[model samples]
Target: MRAKIVFASMTGNDEDMAEILEEDLLDAGLDVDTSDVSFTDASDYLDSDLCVLVTYTYGEGAMTDELVDFYEQLKQLDLSGKYFAVMGSGDKTYKEHYCENVFDFEKAFLACGAKELIAPLTVENAPTDEDIDRIDQAAEELANKLNG
Candidate 1:
């Protein structure tokens, strides 16, 4: 299956999460590609069979600029039937609003007509191996759903 993974990161945490998921998905037999939000176009991502979004929230529930732009563009575009899964990186210490970036992406993807095969996974700052494993499971499910 072909898939695109897009991410918006701060403190290098989300980027690390994206890299791990990308590698795991490839090892699981998928045609996967990764790019940062600034270098990717959400409308273009709609062309992929499956799209995974990884981002982190910061500053009292503020979504990153890249994510905001992508979400705005994606919500306005006609995805029609793109399949999507979301993973968010955040610090639980941030209080009140954690993982807003992942939630934001999920809402936008649905608004643009993408279907979700699983709920968003929000990884706390410096996620554990179990967090990575969960992401692996999510990717596997995504591949199975698309390939089967």
Candidate 2:
């Protein structure tokens, strides 16, 4: 099976999460394509068995620049029945809706009829072992459900 791991980040926390997930996915013997959602074409999500989104929120209750463009530009793509998972990386100290990025991706994918296999997960600073465990487990489950 194939997977796409896409990310948008400012301080690189989100990117790190994407990379970790990519590594885990790769170790699992899946062919995975990964890129920054900003510079990469959003249309790539269409080809993926699973589109894994890792992004961070900036300012207050708003999307990052890459994420903003994704929703505005790529929202028109036909993603019906596609599977997606979102992971948000943010500082809890900010106090302004830490999971907003994950929620935005979740809502956007659902609006486009994409299937969400699991509710989103969030990590602060770096992902803890527990966070990685959750993501890796979910990813494996997604792979099984989609591939079999």
- The model with the greatest lDDT is 1
> Model 2: residues >4 Å from true position, as ranges?
none
Model 2 over residues 1-29: C-alpha lDDT tens digits?
78898888788888878888888788877
Clashing pairs in 2: none
lDDT of 1 by residue, 1-148 (tens): 7789998877888888888888877988888889999999877785687888888888678766776788788888776677889997877777767887688778888888888988898889876889888888887777778777
Structural similarity to truth (TM-score) of each candidate: 0.93, 0.90
The per-residue C-alpha lDDT of model 1 at residue 148 equals: 76
Q: For candidate 1, report its TM-score.
A: 0.93
Pairs clashing in candidate 1? none
The list of candidate 1 runs beyond 4 A from truth reads none
Error of 1 at 115 (Å): 0.5
